[model samples]
Target: MSTLTLEVVAIDDGVPGIRTLTLASPDRAVLPSFTPGSHIVIQCADGANAYSLTGETTSPREYVVSVLECPQGRGGSRWIHRDLTIGSVIVAHRPRSAFAPVLRASRHLLIAAGIGITPMVSHLRSARRWGRDVRLLYVHRKGRGAYVDEIATLTDSASFFTDRTAFVSELSLELASQPFGTHVYVCGPSQFIDDVVTAATALGWPPSRIHVEHFGGDLAPGDPFEVELSCSGDVFTVESGVSLLESLTARGHAIPNLCHQGVCGECRVPVRAGSVVHRDLYLSDDERRDSMMACVSRGSGRLELEL
Candidate 1:
């Protein structure tokens, strides 16, 4: 995959922990176009952390991404907040989409929990432009704690600032009453996503119609495992200290991997042998049956994958 090493032209504080970084375009032609809910891997002081593009990627002029400073985890978002500055050069991979909004659905029910609002904000914007009916249910601890203003702009948007109980009840009722063509997107903390998924499933919503995206929190990294590539006939021994993307890149095998945390799903490959320990927030059961994301996930044992 082609990458653009663009300079950070401008940076602005969007909210308390969020900042918007405007990247200078590398090329003067039509920029890489991405749909709503698309993300690009930005190389920062702390490796690569994927950020969803807030604005539309229409021209070759600029790109905007809102980064919520993460104090914990691996310091990726914190590095962007503290270290990244105007005129600082950073390698940015072309836009990738693992959480794109499903356009086939006539109606969309967007549920965002805290920082997860970033991707859904973009989806809401695109949906509004297309004249599609969208209802945003933003769940937050307090009205001031979340990106409430951003969510308020969308049509039929509701907020639950008190607790999860009220949010789940309202979400269940809203989803149950909606037509069958409605698509539901839930993104936030792992537990929150799980709760929303469980509730929606209990309401008889199709699992395929529910999409989710997770960023951080006690995501226990799995043990390193060995992998054998079927096409290249190459074997790789991923050490415990490194990820599969890093391990493969250290060797001669250049697998296109961006956002090493597995959110972008760029390094997904067909699984031919052995069981894989899936770690990504995306990917359905059908996708897991044939493929595995090589970045975050590791093999249970010796595995064979299509290179």
Candidate 2:
């Protein structure tokens, strides 16, 4: 991906623990055009972090992204919250999207949890411009979500849920009430995304009509496992707390990787043998049959890789 040096034009506290950063070309030139649901990989103090673009895409002059400060995270969010400031120059990759809306759909159903509202905000704007019917359901802890007030001003079709029970009940009804040719877009934590998609599918929504974007991997540690390299016949133990990418790298395996969040497909490796417990969204069903993303995925017992 190509990189661009941009300056932080503005920063604002959207909600508790959420900060919105507006970026633009230092020369005040028109930035590259990006569609709704697109995200850019920003180079942070620790590493590159992918964030969805939440600003206007039509004749765009700037890109806006919201970051939820995670105290226990891998340091990217902490860096953004503490070190990044207005006028600070940063390098970011060009915008890319794997979670865009289906423009041809008759109606759009947007469901977001917490900071996941970032992409939905972009989708709402684009839907208004395209004159497409759209409804938004935003779920977050009371007074804890980002962009609540800004999103509230966008559409009257929006509904906010603070209670998990109420949210699930309402979500089921909403999924059941939508008409034919309606597409659903969901973004949030892994469990939330799974719940939404699973409920939609159980209600007969086709996989093609349900789009999802996972914010990040489940940070909870997993069971320990082993991985064997096919090329070198070397074996390495992947601890319960370490990622496969980190494990391989620690053992002198040079692997090409970009975002450690599993959104980018840069760390994909062929699984020559053994079962893989896939945890990434980058691979398709067919791709999962032969390969897995090393950054977030792991093996059940032992995995043989082409490396």
For all predictions, the C-alpha RMSD in Å is 5.0, 3.3
Tens digit of per-residue lDDT, candidate 2, span 1-307: 3888999999998578998999999998888888788888888887778899999887688999999999988788999999988999999888887678887899999999988999999898888777889999989998887777777777778999899999888999999999899999999987788889899999999988988887764444668999899989999889997999998888888889977877668999999999997766557668889998889888899999997
| RMSD in Å for model 1 | 5.0
Model 1 TM-score, all chains together: 0.76
C-alpha lDDT of residue 266 in model 2: 90
> Which parts of model 2 have CA positions greater than 4 angstroms off?
217-242, 246-252, 263-265, 271-292, 297-305
Model 2 Cα shift for residue 164 (angstroms): 2.1
Model 1 steric clash pairs: none
TM-score of each: 0.76, 0.84
lDDT of 1 by residue, 172-265 (tens): 7887898879999888776777788888888888877988776633244556688898987888788774677777777776788656677656
